[model samples]
Target chain A: MSNSTSNTPEKDHKSSYRAEERRTLSSGEEEFFFDVKTSDMEVNMGPQHPATHGVMRVLIRCDGELVTGSQVHLGYLHRCAEKIGENVEWLQYLPYTDRYDYLAAMNNNLGYSMAVEALMPGLEIPRRAVLLRTINVELNRIASHLVAYGTYGLDIGAITPFLYAFREREWIQALFEKICGARLTYSYIRIGGVFNDAPPGWLKEVGHFCDVFEEKWKEYRDLLALNHIFIKRTAHVGVIPKDMAIDFGLTGPMLRGSGVDFDLRRDMPYMAYGEAYEAGAFKVPVGSGEKGELGDSWDRFYVRVEEMMESIKLVRWCLGVIEDGPIIGEIPKVIKVPAGEAYVGIENPRGELGHYVHSDGGKVAVRCRVRGPSFTNIAVVEELMPGTLLADSVAIIGSTDIVIGETDR
Target chain B: MELQAIHDTLKAAGVVGLLGCDEPRPANKKEKDPGRAGMPFLLVDPAEIVPLLTACRDESRLQFDLLIDLTASDPAADGDDLWVLIQLLSLKYRHRLAIKAHLPKSALSIASATAVYRAANWHERECSEMFGITFEGHPDPRKILLPDDWKGFPLRKDYEFPTEYHGISCE
Candidate 1:
């Protein structure tokens, strides 16, 4: 596996000495040279770099330190999950969903399970299954937001918050492992219900974590949000307006940060969000201060923090409501949906993660199209990146919370 | 609000007859008629697309601002014409309209909507590269998601996936 290299001539002593002489040109002559050949300079950000958060290559066209334009190259982590969904059975593809957005595996599981349930309506899942799904998804949401906040901080040169955020996330992953036997890609969620009920003492452990998390939340806010330097780096930067956000088809925190007041879990209320809980039971606090200024990077960061707090509230609510019942519904071993097409969307940690399933009453889905939130959210970069500094682009992209797996899937 | 009212509005704007919208079914299914579901999508003639989309946006009951998704599907094997489906969502009306236009397998040309919606630039480019369709007035119509020197559209039914591109295997 030898790496490929370009065969361009290296800059030896003669070329360097000649290049140095050109730098000392007169001002008038330099202006003439600049006017005559104003070719765009190409700079490759990475196929292997740290700030990208994953294997993504962006070719940035720049005029000095200002980014003129950028072309994002994907397929670095393309596993063809959609094509794989076609090949596998309907029930077996739940595991592959975890790999799409591994940061929020439970949300991925919930989205796929909801799509299947919508296709095969009247599966008769017990109340316990719904509560367990809500708890697992909210826990996943907290873990995902922790990574987004931690990595965003890391991008802006903060190290302590990233370590603290991961320290808390490890505990949540351990809770998931105890229930499903696998940590990250736990395909615990089934078509009509979940794979198994929560183990003994699982609810008690989750309850204790929620109490501990409330204290840790204050510490996080004090450590990072209250810091003057972090605020200066984030506030009023990468401000996404509400109208432009709607125009670009943005959703989730990206939309809520813009003061849209639209959440699928609240607005559409799939799963146990509406039926099993009260209206104000799980309150995810959206940031509110001013009108046009709501969607700035600071608000975007604060929205995630408040969302973590809300998820904790929902987890506690689920732990209280969870009871002993049949976990798996009366679904046949070989599942077959009706011959029709349905588009099912769930409020994933990222945004509106939708699965459009078309079945022919066959063994496998005829076509399964995923409307990835990252793909739509990242498209607004062309609208946002025109007049920003080169360095601020990284901060803006990080704040959007895009995973390349979902973007390129 | 209804498909007929929107169709009448487009007709008043000098569009041709609105082709019947066909709800696609499985290959082996016996049903061939397009009925009125809870939400109905109207298919318009390809030549009248630019005017119809413009009228649909300007009309009071139908202000389809958001182009939800656009893609081309191969229907030649199913004894049907090749069609491009443009799904539009109206935020004001809270409705979805799927406009369909059929062309011969060889010639798949439609008017570009980049002038109407800025977001259609990349979506049209992606469709063009995947289905070998041509958007007549597309600005900077270049290949996206695929290389410039790539041979054929991979998503087309008869198209074959290449083993390598510029010495890098696509696999």
Candidate 2:
């Protein structure tokens, strides 16, 4: 199909397509000439495109069939979350965090609450609350990763894997609903601890979920992870170097996929993670390129798969150690954080979610800033996008697993 | 490196304009938060920011390689002029340090950190558009989270909510 038979399909498709496009565009009897500016194009990939997964537009420039460069345009969903945080009471701000990373709302809640807690007097979390939080947040992480995995499958040509992943996610949502009232935006993780303690038999149900999920995880892997086409689309595409990943401030799986052994849960060891990590049973799996180039789209995709398994392991551990006690901490009804600033970062499913709170000894904060992980992580797409074919760019974006809620917020 | 050691090194290196640790801690919650606990920040002269941050990144022991965040706060209770907090993290030693610099309302500008950390590009852009502080040498300093012709910096405590944006009633 190439203009010359001397070229391979991979290298020649673009030339052939461009030639065909030119022939069609200038085919009239009237005189016509090929123009490079008209031939070479810039494509806007959406504030509404399904592939974008949320309200975001990617401005991509293409030479023939290959993308030459790109830029990310966000803020379509900017609700001024920070400005609202400054106006609302401390407790009223919890629900707004829910909408930031809606897929990982619990983690967002936990991160924001912890930042506020840093400003409180005598704010040490209880052991029982820690264990409960470890369970709930890790469960939320599993649910978040399920969305990422399922949608990545959707981004690729697979339909059934989305069903499989969502079926499991539904189970987790039901469990979360039993403990907290809502499913999607469950503002369960309050400032001091969880909104409430787990109901009786909830931990046993988690154990059951983990046991059944392990076998299903293998089947899900067999369906897509080992599929040759999935491998072809992702492997060796969007390769990122470790130093570049660090310089761009990618955290969580995005950083780990590039072979960085840094996870705030393990490194900083907040909540119940310190003891679990100290026991030496916790595992941090970096990209070994088991099936693709290091830090490629496949490596990023695989890291999420492996992290889901780790979340299950964490849930099991928390269930084993959880003790009976008060879930809520003794925070004052009319909360007045001291006049100062506090910043705290927690490992969300997407990456490092940090909350910065500046209070002027008032009922509401002076400024509540969020360093959304997806906001920073999404910036690396431009570095990975150029020189890749248009199709592969979709794979890279999907592999990064960003919720545009976090990106645009 | 311990914070005290990093503080001593900054002092010994003869970087001027750093306020001492006796600036009456921010509202007595210092005993709980570690980063700002006894957080003695260097009030770097605006002209010397690039060199100070570059040293923090390249220094052998206190390699503050990660630019955690670059944010501007109105700090309304303290001053009319806004303050910018440049947070740096050292991956080598697992320590974090803060650099505080203030910008007056008349000329709200400071040297950009993009030359030192590429991650600063977007954060700096966001900070500039939201708080109206100019990142002097940022490669592409455009309004990131707002419309290009947006009238005011929304994050400043005194910023009034617009009654309308481009003829659409916002009130």
* Chain A TM-score of each candidate structure, as shown: 0.88, 0.90
**Which DockQ-derived CAPRI band holds candidate 2?**
acceptable
lDDT of 2 at B76: 79
Candidate 1 chain B lowest-lDDT run of ten: B32-41
Candidate 2 lDDT over A1-409, as tens digits, reads 1112211122211212343333321113321332444456899999887778998999989876667678888888888998898889998999999999999988998999888887775676777888888888888888898888888989987888999999999999999999998999998888888877778888899899999999999987888877777887777677777888888878879989988877888877788898887766468778877665577777888888888888888888887777887877787788877655677888999888988787766799877889898988898887777656788878888989999888778
* DockQ (model 1, Cα): 0.21
Candidate 1 matches the true fold with a TM-score of 0.82
Q: Please give me the DockQ of candidate 2 compared with the native complex.
A: 0.38
Name the runs in model 2 displaced over 4 angstroms.
Answer: A1-38, B13-17, B21-42
